[model samples]
Target chain A: MKDFPGTPGTLTGLMLRVGQFTFAAASIAFVATGVRFQEFTAFCYLIASMGLQVLWSLWLACLDAYAMLAPRDLRNPRLVSLFVVGDWVTATLSLAAACSSAGILVLYDRDLGNCKESVCQRYQFAIAMAFMSWVLIDISSLIMFWLLAAG
Target chain B: MKDFPGTPGTLTGLMLRVGQFTFAAASIAFVATGVRFQEFTAFCYLIASMGLQVLWSLWLACLDAYAMLAPRDLRNPRLVSLFVVGDWVTATLSLAAACSSAGILVLYDRDLGNCKESVCQRYQFAIAMAFMSWVLIDISSLIMFWLLAAG
Candidate 1:
């Protein structure tokens, strides 16, 4: 496919693909675990992740659509705005998922009974670090996109 | 002080610092449990993780030093070569550390002579996730850098 939002599209695609695989893996785990413990909470988080990813993906697709459709000489700010929307929403979800995962861990430790794993503790740690990683990427991406837009 | 390779440097710093803390935490268990048990292998992996992290932290520092003192604009392809070197080395070490952590987990499970809570497993899983996250970031960053450069 032709490039859309220039460099920002690459970042978006990378993030979305990562989200896709992560959610898919989590779903597989949910299926394999037998009982539906951790399902509601994890599913909520997974859907959020995938929802943001799909929106971002569609935005890119539309950006592509616009790029292909816009007149060759046109220089519109709307395209850039489309990307920024994706950037911030992804950032918000990235932050939310991380925070909620931590909160869920605390609840689990208190024996809320939504999850059962001999290693449930590890999920909290895993999600927290994953959140940090995503935030780093999201923020840097926002900066880079804004700079490219503004510069 | 400026953000040269911002994502790479920041994530590396976070991983190295956290990984070291994990190493120390695991070390206490590994040592307290004595050297013969396979959690000692976990200890060994911790040390290995620490050693590799130290190298990464140094390399990132060196890149900063080189950028600041080498009298070169970072836009120069030659100057940007640092990212490639750092990315490859980081990818290799990260994968190795991840694999070693997995091995340690198996060994720890098999040799119950060690392991207090599942806490150490959290350390193992978190650091492994950290390393893997950075590797994904590294690969994507290079691809983004290349595409941006190419365009």
Candidate 2:
């Protein structure tokens, strides 16, 4: 086995840090700029999801360390493939959420519930799914990792 | 170094097949038996998510080939780790969603919109998130995988 100059562990650590930083910056920006009760509330939820997701990403980064340093001897190859694929899913989901959070801020600017087919309203389903799904998947994935680790 | 007995070339293919199967089965079950208009609608949504999720799982399964067949020098550790960790996240999310989906189906039976308890309401939010989320993540992950492969 080989190790990167910074160690494979640090590479993931960097990603987690950047993800957290983006989420934090977004939250601050949203609160400072967004208006309306629902928009504000959704912004808060978005922040909450981002916060949780960063932690989730970090946790998986650590697991990557484990998989490299100490993958189970009798691991299922199919499961390993599944694990990698799911990581992409979560990261893309996170990115979707980041874009949606921006969209949410836009919706707040326009107050789209009072309007229709506005950019925010048009993709609100995707935007809303972005944040809400992040939370749901984050919590669920955390549980799954714990189980896999324990098992 | 080692390959699984049967590795699917594209999780994309599997996801499509699973989506189709889930839709057909869920739809047939609903139509052949009986369901309220609202249940039918929710079922429709569930079927969409469920089918997509099947593809997501297959995608992860397919990634195993990269892990097994790629030349050692050409393999990128960071990229490989990303693939494996993603598989873990998606699988976990699927398991969590399977649990949540079952719960939501029950709530759907009881009428989710009318619920008043804060916890129940939260679960409603959580389940709705689960349904849309797994599917969204599935599609987004595939796109990202393609972009990375293309880039």
> For every model shown, what is its TM-score relative to the native structure?
0.38, 0.34
Q: Write the per-residue lDDT of candidate 1 for residues A34-121, one digit (tens) a residue.
A: 3443444542564456455545545554544454455231234565455555565665455445444444444445424556565564
Position B121, candidate 1: lDDT: 55
> For candidate 1, what is the interface RMSD?
12.7
Superposed model 2: Cα runs more than 4 Å off: A1-16, A31-33, A36-44, A54-113, A116-151, B1-20, B23-151
Clashing pairs in 1: none
List CA RMSD, all candidates: 10.9, 12.1
- Candidate 1 DockQ category? incorrect
lDDT of each: 0.46, 0.42
TM-score of 2: 0.34
What does the interface RMSD come to for each candidate?
A: 12.7, 13.2
Best lDDT among the predictions, by candidate number: 1
For candidate 2, lDDT tens digit of each residue in A1-151? Answer: 2222222234443344344445444443444343442433334545554555556556655655665566432134455345445644564445444443443334334433444444344334434444444454443343333323333
